[model samples]
Target: MTHISTTNPATEETIATYDVMTSDVAFDKIEKCHEAFLEWRTKSHADRAPYLRKIAAALRDNADAFATLMTEETGKLLRDGQTEVKLCAQIFEYTAEHGPEILADEDRKHSGGEKRGMITYAPIGVIYSIQPWNFPVYQPVRVLASNLMAGNGVILKHASICTGSGLMLRDVCMKAGLPEGLFDVVIVDHDTSDAMIENKLVRGVTMTGSDGGGRHIGQVATKNLKKSVLELGSNDAYLVLEDADIELAVKTCVQGRLYNNSETCVSAKRFVVTEAVYDAFTSAFVEQMKAIRLGDPTAEDTQLGPLSSAEQFDTISEQVSKSVEGGAEVLCGGSAPDRTGYYYPATVLANCQPGTPAYDDEIFGPVAAIIKAKDDADAMRIANDSRYGLGGGIFSKDEDKALQLARDHFDTGMVRINSFGAADPNMPFGGVKDSGFGREHGGFGMKEFVNTKAIYLP
Candidate 1:
């Protein structure tokens, strides 16, 4: 079985080759992970932190190489890719720094003098991780670092295009001095993955991908009576009230969408603007979008890279076409670049209707769907109508009012008022509804990989 094959999204050309894991090897790796789980669970969080720190050191030591490889594999800018590695380090370091305290027994006494109780954390065994190509490095590390720190073994089934990222992460773990099988990377296509999910050795599952991917995994995990943590795609709204700063909102919108070539799950998909400043916001947004530099992801000056894969380019292109037909006025950049990889120029749309495909559908490209509303109520209504509720942003001069509106109205799991949000090592990031379930970062992240045990000590 072939484990890997080299391909570039930029030139749409074969770069190299790799091996794939057959079912037999996949099962063996699962078995090893299950066996390794027993030993890994014996260590304390204190013991785990040193290993995590070593992983952090290794990530910093090999930042450039890892970033270059990541850029080659996933078509993110080298700086972005390097930044991902640094975040991966922070995932480990944060878990190492805080996991122990969170997992430590909490001494709580009932005010009614009922009893005293202590809560403890335990390894939940081998977790099946299915990650996407967009965040080839940080996604897996977010789940894996917390899992390892909490004393659980991890079995990664990474994106075929980003198989190298998973392998490289394992190498980093080994370099950090983890025991064999504690963090195993298995290569398997989709169907074979289903088989592994049913395996008794695999006790839990977590995924970071599209809504469809999350739902499919959710079904599998539910049928098998296992746990799952998902970080799915979001048609997250960026609400720009009439009182909003045109410059700040425009700048943040461009930053959010163009970052990752708009391959991010939580990229601001819709722009909900009140009619008062709608034209100014739209003009400023288009101007900024035009200013974004699209070049080889490896280049330092590149602000945007090609879509990570040929398939994604087609889907995004089709989405843009269909959205335009559904009544969105294409303001700029609705076509692919004449380049090697799957390159689409940044696009901006105006006159987007509430029920239009462009309005609710997640824009996974450099396209921003603009939905104009007569008033704040209409803006809120449009923003809250999406089935997806992952992450959202609000821009307004009345920060307090905007926050309250977001808190009360938006259905997303997290909100960034006047700022573009990403996975912060210290914050819990997740989603609701079609965007998937469970959390991937911070305290919630560490808990995802562990089994909680209660001790009643009176």
Candidate 2:
């Protein structure tokens, strides 16, 4: 009898309500997904690739409708929604084209070349995915694209706020010739979700959310002896070196911060600038943040949109307030406006030091925390001081030096030099430390839930 209500954060209106599935119903769906996996696993990778291509074409064909639905449900900009659809389509295409090559069986010589051996990547059963509202389509597609190509069925328990998008994606896949039950979305309460995770049919669990959620899911998967991949939240830092292009750094950082209305996990939340360029970068960054147009998400000129929900707005507001109380200076925006919906203006916090939320926590909104470093070394040190290391960036005129630093010094899972990006289908994505474990994309995801069976021919 329980249900989830989808709301438009930009308009503060309920879009639709979906009934939550009972434990029995959820289990039935899981059973069906497992059955689909059994049948899907029997197909060759070549056979699977065409369906993925069809899915990609369907995504493009329906991009407008899907993007509008996402924007309506999550308050993301219309353009952003469209971009997400395109990105997801690209992910499906990439997985279809490259998955088989990545999952091909490997031949090796055993015991000093005396015997022949082979290692095959075999599909497991159902993979349970728990995704977030931000980048609703991309988050789920990122997991689904790889798993589908790997011949594994997927079951999604998406964020309550974006349940509609989740179900829509499932429908889209099915409409694109994906077999029934190959991808399923379950609307359920927390208890039901936990029960699903505990279900023996689910061989692996992949989640993209906060660290707290990741910990709970990871523990459950561990206790049940199921594999898991967690992509948790982070307060990623973007370092501006003394020799950096201040203008370019400011521009890129602004785009990164406000990309998803500044609700992205990998968005540059913290700005660590060397003393030499700190003033310039901070001034320009604050000015840009101050001038951002925050209004209707459908407006083409609007640069920032509302937070995904009132709860999300409250969280960001409290984080900013606590940071200010902890000795951080508000450069532009520090409080919510009196406007309707869950709108929070683009905010910039400076004079940030350790022991402050601005310095330590992830501000999941249109807020930027600026930190001053004595030099490049100090900037690097400051960037590595965070407990979360999901992703980070460094900007320097010397591309070689920046590349080396990112390769050898940056402690995060993914890093960008002289630019910023959320993800690339061909590159490995994930993080270390409290940011959670396991990589996605870049052929890594296609094998995460696959069994590597070893065979010896003596």
Candidate 3:
């Protein structure tokens, strides 16, 4: 009789409640997914492409409805919700078009001249995905689209706050001609989720969440001897170098920090500015942050929305308070408003130093920490002084120098020069260090849960 209730963060109203499945019911879903995988793996890549295309069409056809539902469930901007659905559609289209070529067997010449070798990519069994609520549709679709194209079945245990989005996606896939049991959404508690990870049929575990959650899942998967991919939390730094464009840097950095209510893992949480332009960038950034319009997510004029939940709001508020107590300065916003819903303003913290939450922790809300560096070298050094290395950015007028810095100096898995973006379908995404491992976009994701078999011909 366990249940999870969904709420509208903007209105503070309950939307609906869903019953959590018992252990037996959850296992039955897993069994059905495994059975589908057996048949799906036997199909050729060509046969799977059309179904993926159908999924893309279904997403696009129902984008408006799905986007509204996501906004209602997660407090994301309505326009952003629509954009998320479109991005997911693009992922499906990309996987369908390129999956066959990427998964094709590679012809290789053996070290011995007399022998020839070929490497073939083969689909593994069910992949268990545990996703977060920030980018509800895109997050799950990022894993599901690539896995389905690789001929593997997927079972999702999405964040309880967005359970309706997960189930709706499953319904959309089925309506698009996807075979039943191929993709399943399970509603279960934490204990059942851990047991599902240990299930023999789940060959791989992929999760996108906090660093703490990643550690727990990674340990459980390791104990069970299953391959796991974790995309954990990050406090990514966006460096404003001495030779940067001040105007462009200020605008882009603000957008980077406040996008998606600033809940994005790859969003620019820390601003590392060189001494040469630190004053100018900081002034402009604070002014812009203070002017942001925070209101109803459904309103087109509203640039920011409430946090996904009250817990998220409390976490951000506590981090800001601790950072201020540890010697950080509030440039614009530092406290939550006395409002009915879980709303926090776009905040900018200045004079940020090490050992403070503002500088060290990932503030998963609309808060930006600004730090001053002596020069470009110092800025780069400051950016790398973090345990989390998921994503970072560089802003410089010299494209050549920025590209060189990104390639040679940046220590993260993904970096941008003079720009900020969450993800791209054609690029490899993921991170190193405490941010977790495994790449998810481009052609890399299609093979993460696949097996590589080598055959030699002499």
Candidate 4:
């Protein structure tokens, strides 16, 4: 049997190994999940709340262990891992608290009020979730909690690097009163995963990864006539306007970029600075980015952690090299320290023109690309220049102008005004254009895989 081994990216220490399942085994598991869904779909939304609540409690109870495992597996900062655990718990709690209402049957008028109709959101079937390693706990939970509450069984195909986290999540759900086979994590290869997506038992699919991967899976699911929700990658831009407070912009941009070691899909990757404050913002941002020392993720004093894997380290390093070759200037960090683990320092690049990775592609690490804009209008233009529209930010002392820009002109699904955050349960999270379609969180996800059936009464 082929086995997958997980390692601590910070220390390059092997953590655990697990055997991969055959396509047949995975298919059989899907059959079992469909059976569970058959029974689960009979329950009212209220009946599902208790299960989610218990899972949330279990997550909190085991927060430290889960955080430790995440740190060991992906080199996530301990504090960030702990926060991820909390966020996962909150997601479960949020689903439990609000799912019933979100999925509640609604009365409506049809035929110009001549007929009364009731629209019901019904569970489809098994939902196949393809999640990434970056935010392992939260990524799976975003789909799992909502789907379970909506009365669908969920199967998670997490990234190979964080296999343990996926299995551990399944264990927690089972122990927290989730019915057996209702939520399962499959240890299978990509080919098996595609086969599972084409399985009749799986009614829908959700994926979080690169646009390239999203397109492949989305096509497969579409070919199978299955519904799909894809939350893909992004090269999100954060703009510092002429009237912005350089201190806040610098600090928030750094936090946004370095969060999760900058592996996040929605994190700030591009900085568009208006000429008025270009000098101030770039100077402070580069200085602060330089001061962030890469060290042991488990250490409290360490401000920056290693990339998630040796592959990730190499990818970031190469991207930086190519960006510099393509006329981008490394303002702060451009080289990885000779270390035991997959360590890459916080880096900032300027003079980032088009046709470079720093200018157009998503560099999934602690590297920041700075683009100079002629003015505020040019900054917005630069921010919207990318093919990606997952999330972006605008920092201006004018709250009204920032809100207006985010609401009207900012061409992303989500925008943060003068602040930085990964996600909030109360807000919808997803992206547009190359970032992919569909929204998750704030009740949007609960309906993504459900069937909207309209019942009419004459």
TM-score for each predicted model, relative to the true structure:
0.96, 0.99, 0.99, 0.99
Candidate 1, residue 225: Cα displacement in angstroms equals 0.2
**C-alpha RMSD values across all candidates:** 1.6, 0.9, 0.9, 0.9
**Position 336, candidate 2: lDDT:** 82
Clashes within 3 Å, all models in order: 12, 0, 0, 0
Sorting all predicted structures by lDDT, with the top scorer first, yields 4, 3, 2, 1
Alpha carbon lDDT of each predicted model: 0.84, 0.93, 0.93, 0.93
For candidate 1, what is the lDDT? 0.84
Off by over 4 Å in 2: none
lDDT of candidate 3? Answer: 0.93
What would the per-residue lDDT of candidate 3 be over residues 240-334, giving only the tens digit for each residue?
99989999999999999989989899999999999999999999999999999999999999999999998998899999999999899988888
lDDT per residue as tens, model 4, 317-382: 899999999999988888888879998888999999899999999999999999999999999999
lDDT at 189, model 1 = 79
At residue 44, candidate 2 shows an lDDT of 92
Report the error of model 3 at residue 36, Å. 0.5
